[model samples]
Target: MTSNTEVFPVLETKRLVLREITKKDANSILDYLSDAEVMKYYGLDPFNSLDNALDEIAWYQSIYSNKTGIRWGITLKEQGVVIGSCGFHNTVSQHSRTEIGFELSKGQWGKGIAAEAVEAIINYGFKHMHLQRIEALIEPPNLSSQRLVEKIGFVREGLLRNYEFTRGKFDDLYMYSLLKQDLDKINSM
Candidate 1:
């Protein structure tokens, strides 16, 4: 089995493919990244141009190269277009834990696509990366995402007040987590 630490792996679901985000995917991902509505809860402002997407892709590559984190472009299997991105960030190997983050185009909302992608990556984190815990820090106002994480089995730990500044303000975030034990329990069901 290939270790996730040594190589980035492509994860898949029935309708989606999570693969490395590349420069070629910039234009495809540009739609959502630049949409203020989509990026509302994100830590950064909406992209002003395709150049912003390119820069974001480069940043993703840099983190992977440094073995700091892995980000995947969430591609639709039928349409063959990237609709979003998701991945582990703020990874702490010694702690056997990492945080999850994701964003999807406004058009893709309410389709359960994010749930599928999150499930696949969560499995990869537990089974392939041997992570004991995976956490998600979400802006309190992102009800859709909070529901998504909860549906995927992440337990809400607590809220972090003024966690980080985003979109020109310090935002409160809810902390959610899933443990390896939780996955194992479900598998043994």
Candidate 2:
């Protein structure tokens, strides 16, 4: 097996391919941004225009290439479309510890794509990023996301009171995490 520290161009899965974001993916990302239902829990205003979306996509790609920590865009394998974005987030102490986040298209919900993407990113984190622990900060209104994290084996550490200003006001966020050792054991089975 390869060491858990090698960075690759992309990590391919059965249904999705984990890769860096691109300029061309801006419009699809805007699709996700336009949906009020999609952004309801994410705590962000709608993208004003395609240019705004393009700027966001460019930001993700440029920072990633420069090694700045942020979320990654999730692309569908067969369709080659940007259905959502998910990746390492919330850099604390220069990436020594960071959180994991994912957002998918409303059309693709309930298909386990988020889990698959999270699994791939988790493997990437453990194998390549030297990430000791991966955190998932979820909103209280989002029970489905909480379930997804639990199903992926992340333990609910506790509730962070007024941790994030989401959906307008400060919301108590749930902290969920998984260790690299636990991933090693889980994947070994």
- Clash pairs, model 2 backbone: 4-127
Instruction: For each candidate in the order shown, give its overall lDDT on alpha carbons.
Output: 0.85, 0.77
Instruction: Identify the leading candidate in terms of TM-score.
Output: 1
Candidate 2 per-residue lDDT, tens place, 73-181, comes to 6778877888898887555545556788788999999998998888888887877777788888888779999998888789999999998775578989889989877
Candidate 2 weakest lDDT stretch, 10 residues: 1-10
User: Which 10-residue window of candidate 1 scores lowest in summed lDDT?
Assistant: 1-10
What lDDT would candidate 1 get against the real structure?
0.85
Candidate RMSDs in Å, in order, are: 3.0, 4.4
Candidate 1, residue 111: Cα displacement in angstroms equals 0.8
- In model 2, which runs have C-alpha deviations exceeding 4 angstroms? 1-8, 93-95, 185-189
